[model samples]
Target: MRRKSIQNWRRSNSPVLKRFCASIGKSLGLPNQVADYWDTMLGGKSSSTDYFENYLLSEIDSPIVIGLDHVEVIFQYPEIASNFFCLLRTWNEKAKYGNSLSQVWEKLRLVVVYLTEVYMPLMIHHSSFNVGLSIGLPEFSRNQVQDLVQRYGFNWDSDQIKQLMSLVGGHPYLLQTALYHIWQQDFLLEELLAKYTINVRIYSEYLSEQLSNLRQYPELYAAFTQVTNSPTPVELEWEQALQLQTMGLVHVRGDRVLPSCNLYRQYFNVSASHLQEFHPKSGRAEG
Candidate 1:
């Protein structure tokens, strides 16, 4: 499902688990009376684990795929997150048991998408993330970017593409945004790159969102600061490096880390003073 649809629930005053169940019930096409009945009956005494297993088995008769995007927001609620994820593992395992109920569970497929690793601890046996066919999308290569440029009907030469890649690396979203704006004649390629770091017109919202996330975790903010400020790759704590790499903010080479792209380095560097406010003491403080 779209992240925006559920993101507001995360910030709501009501209990997250209730909102979560309500959303699921709605997706299952249960009427409000039935859903509310279940909520009133089970909300106080049981967890989502019980609700999903019992309800999904009886409710669904066809193959159902639930795609959850931006699942990282749930990490902030560890108890609910852990319980829900473990429930997913249980559902998957139940489908493999070769019992009558297996047929029901086998019809249920899950697609959980998140930007970063689960920093929080989860029992391996109970973790659904470990069992899935994980797919990690790598950044586009230079050739891929060039292909995209041509696909966008741009007749730019190799050097022009190179200059654009140098600024945004091969980030798909950034490349698309730049290409779209230039294609619309909003700015020339040279003008776009020249004013990229200074102007907030292109990547202001994206950069601001990343900055806000980093501010939430001071150690991550500090670790990213070091990576951006350095001329060469810098060493970071294993967890810190992993988290930053997963967040698409930095690239890890061996034991060293560097900014993922010139865009990140330039944008974050300009905001370095603001970042320093998050961790005034050390740039390498552990999160």
Candidate 2:
């Protein structure tokens, strides 16, 4: 049977519970009455849950998948995020009753996508995340990177690919961006790698954004600086390490963490130096 899919509801755009319910209602092709009801309910957590359950059982005839993208945005609003996720978990539980109601509840599926780990506290039994199958996408492997390189119409030899990987590791975004620029801008691989610092024109914007994000949390910034400055992996506080790993800034192995790519190390090292130069007493950048 064909499934109905709500491509995504970016929580960042509708963080409020009522707005969130309205977005879902609209996506499900529900009439204005549903949205009006949500607004009228004043976004009561239980009311919103019951509304979705009743609506799906009565109106939705086919399986529907709701995709919640950029879910990390809600992490900033812990109360709402906790209540919202618990509501989802409750719905999932309702699907397992082995009755006619279960059939309707089973028709509703969810696809939640986020960049960071959920650091906010959540009860194990009430979290949808804890109950779902978790999938982690690691950096591309050497062969996978080569396959992508060839697909970009490059006839780069093993040595050239190795050089590129040495600078950016197997990060798909960094690798793809570099390959595209090299192919389209006619830049020689060696020349590009030679100028592969954080200030390089191609990567400055992205690198700057990462730096800005790191600066927001001074402790995380300091922890990451330690990782970047060390030639070998360094052990950090567990939460700091996990947060950095989630930010795609560091790779964590066992109790040790290291910069995710040479690009990060090069950039952050220069940044740290500049911070030391300007703030010699503290040797740390202010958030």
Candidate 3:
């Protein structure tokens, strides 16, 4: 597709996207034709985030609640998550008031649509799900996922909790994304996190990208080192957080990951070559 795949799409916020999507959609009263053409180009979302959005975008919007379990689903397809993260940024920048991304999430239809279409199919077949699943989080036994969520203090009624735990585990990435999804989907935020788990391989590519960034932008690395080496606090940037989360470099901890993990801790953590092998998309690593 000329419209680059998920990865390229998330790489940056083209200043023109808002204007582009809006101009096309508004000019035609609804870019039905463009959207239809997109359907053909992208294969019409047979089973993915776009599928969910197809239905969700037309529904309610506001005061939605999300649990960590929900975030796991969104993470399953990180490419699509750019929209959610971007929407969050947009809301943060202009909310018609002073609310933050969290407040806007519950009312966000675009993200909800994304979760319903792309991730649910994966969830339906998995035994256990977590953040690592996108990293891909292996589906676990039913009992395991339930237990993971319970541990996080989110009370998913045993009845539909499975829906929540479908994508990932207790891993911070999955945990945070799950939470974000639930809010976007209009559910109650019973628990902040419903599960946890670990999948290191997916993170390796993530590490590579980080190192790539460091190498590409030495100044950025220098900025990071100042924060890493100093006791003084560092200001957080939503733009960077959006990039890292999209690249799978860190988990979502209340909107920011702040670099915490074994991968993050060791030798300044530049071993993407080692980690890439285990990734679902990337082949196995060498000995």
Local accuracy of candidate 2 as per-residue lDDT tens digits, 1-287:
01111123333444355555666778777763444445443555666765676773458788888887776666655576677777777766676453556766777777777765333333432356676667868889999999999998889899988988888888887898889888886586888877754226788877887887777677888999999999999999988887788777888889999987888899899888998987888876576
lDDT of each: 0.73, 0.72, 0.39
TM-score of each: 0.79, 0.80, 0.27
Tens digit per residue, CA lDDT, model 3, 146-199: 676666566777655654443343345544555555546534444322322222
The local lDDT score (0 to 100) that residue 138 gets in candidate 2 is 82
Considering every candidate listed, which one attains the maximal lDDT?
Answer: 1
Measure candidate 3: CA RMSD.
Answer: 16.6
- Runs off by more than 4 Å, candidate 3: 1-109, 112-202, 229-259, 267-287
- Give the lDDT of residue 189 in candidate 1: 90
TM-score of 1: 0.79
RMSD of 2: 5.4
TM-score between model 3 and native? 0.27
Tens-place lDDT per residue, model 1, 1-287, is: 44564567666866655666677778778743333335545552255545655674468677887788877666666665676677666666666563665666677677877765333333422365776668877889988998999998988899998899888888888899999898888888999878854346788988888887887787788789889999999999988887788778888899899988898898888788654566656533346
